[model samples]
Target: MATSTFRVNVLLKEGVLDVQGKAIESSLPELGVSSISNVRVGKLIEFSFDHEGSSLTDEEQTKLTKVCHELFSNPVIESYTLTEVK
Candidate 1:
């Protein structure tokens, strides 16, 4: 069996208030950083799975999607993207 690596990016949806992002943005000027706007904080999760064959199968795709929805992110306020790492 080979191991496949995946990266999951989880972030708050548009129109949702990102309080932590706001706080960091507010403090940037004081930290001598300027001209940065629209700051948003998010999570990056990298994981690997053991499987057969060269690439992920349809079932693996579905399972990863389900995991993203059920575990890594909140379906109501957050969105996630999954990508295979080569």
Candidate 2:
């Protein structure tokens, strides 16, 4: 069996309200930095799976992506990207 690492990048949808990001944006001017316009926050997740890369097919990858979409991400407010890495 081979083990592969995967990286997941998650971000808020455009026009979504981010309270934390909003707070950061509001505070930037107090710190004497006035060039910033907007801010958004996001999450990054990484994990590994053990499987036979030689045999695991594209269908399996699709299945995994669907599982991620269903279980790991909120479709209403966020989007995610999954990538296989060595």
Off by over 4 Å in 2: 54-56
Best model number under TM-score = 1
State candidate 1's TM-score.
Answer: 0.93
Kindly report which residue pairs in candidate 2 clash with one another.
Answer: none
Give, for candidate 1, the lowest lDDT window spanning 10 residues.
Answer: 49-58
Q: Please report how far candidate 2 places residue 43 from its true position, in Å.
A: 1.2
- The Cα RMSD in angstroms, rounded to one decimal, for candidate 2 relative to the true structure is 2.0
Q: Judged by lDDT against the true structure, how good is candidate 2? A: 0.82
Model 1 lDDT per residue over 1-86, tens place:
78988899999999999999999999999989998999999999999988778887899778888999999999899999898888
Return the number of clashes found in candidate 1.
Answer: 0
Model 2 is weakest, by summed lDDT over 10 consecutive residues, at 48-57
TM-score of each: 0.93, 0.79
TM-score, candidate number 2: 0.79
